[model samples]
Target: MTLHRFKTCATSFLAPFILAGVLAGVLAGLSACSGNEGANYEYDYPTVSSDKFQRQRLEELEGGDETVFGELSIGGPKKRGGAAAGEGFATVNYYLWRATLETLSLGPLESADPFGGVIITDWFTLEEEPGSQYRVTAYILGRQLRTDNIKIALYVRPKGTGKAKMDPHRASAVAEAKLENVILSKARTIRATQFK
Candidate 1:
């Protein structure tokens, strides 16, 4: 029974990793198949468009419905969700990302991950409001500069000298809302100034 349980646990733990490896192998095979145009010693296959009889036959069979206008694409069709083979996957709005950094300049930045769209600020206290300390964390979810795509979290605690139980960092909705407004406003201003 113990051996069986261990087998089950081990299988469950490693199943996801094995599946991921298989997926990566398949994707690599697909990408390798797409770049064959540059391969050396490759045989040139004839398409229907290259042959006179086949092109005329195909046109007659399809009744000219297959005639595609504009530039012909050799690559996969463009669609939403997921990146193509060569395009970089950048989902965060640059305006909101820059604005978050600028708005949180009052506090020392702890960590910023551009690709992950996360910004964490160290705890800081304003000279004007010494009674409270604030820490800010911002998340930019997508490429769009919409209010719903950005989130701000503000933690506040009383400025205490010694370790105090009551002065623990508490999440403040009001502070978060205010910070969100400020960040969005700054992002809009930056977008207007830069894009114009």
Candidate 2:
């Protein structure tokens, strides 16, 4: 009787383990039969193609004209006096159509994050002429978020031909004007659409 009770207790204890092993095998077989080799792949973020963005921007500026040019650049600031090596900032510049580059719309700068990037959503109308080109320089300021009084300047010129012969100050002014014109025009369009 003693032997029989011991055997029964052992069987009960082993029963759960045996059941778990059987379930695991069954699951493995089902997974194999389902043709799932555990080769799941995923991309976390939306893949933003430079070409795609440029094309989209150009299309917006061209009013669906279907003829447009788009270019983009991204890189760090040039090294200056030997403060720290490999510590610099970079910017992504975008130029769409053939509008001249002018102003940068830099967002607020915080002490904790002293420097910020700008996105220039530029819109303008120009007379149809050859070699008419526009450049939009997206300036990026690199600041030390923590230690040291380090600041770096980085810029990327949107892809285009021709040149706007203006000094930095004048270029900024022109850009601001263009931006204003774009905003005003867009607002007018919206108003007209609403009223109509």
TM-score of 2: 0.22
lDDT of each residue in 20-128, candidate 2, tens digit only: 9999999998887877567798779978899999887554433321111112212233343466422433321112111112222322221221123333333222344
TM-score of each: 0.53, 0.22
Best by lDDT: 1
**Model 1: ten consecutive residues of lowest lDDT:** 64-73
lDDT value, residue 146 of candidate 2 = 16
Error of 1 at 119 (Å): 0.5
Q: Global lDDT of each model?
A: 0.71, 0.37
Strongest candidate by TM-score: 1
Give the poorly placed runs of model 1, Cα more than 4 Å off: 1-90, 165-167
User: C-alpha displacement of 143 in model 1, angstroms?
Assistant: 1.1
Error of 1 at 113 (Å): 0.5
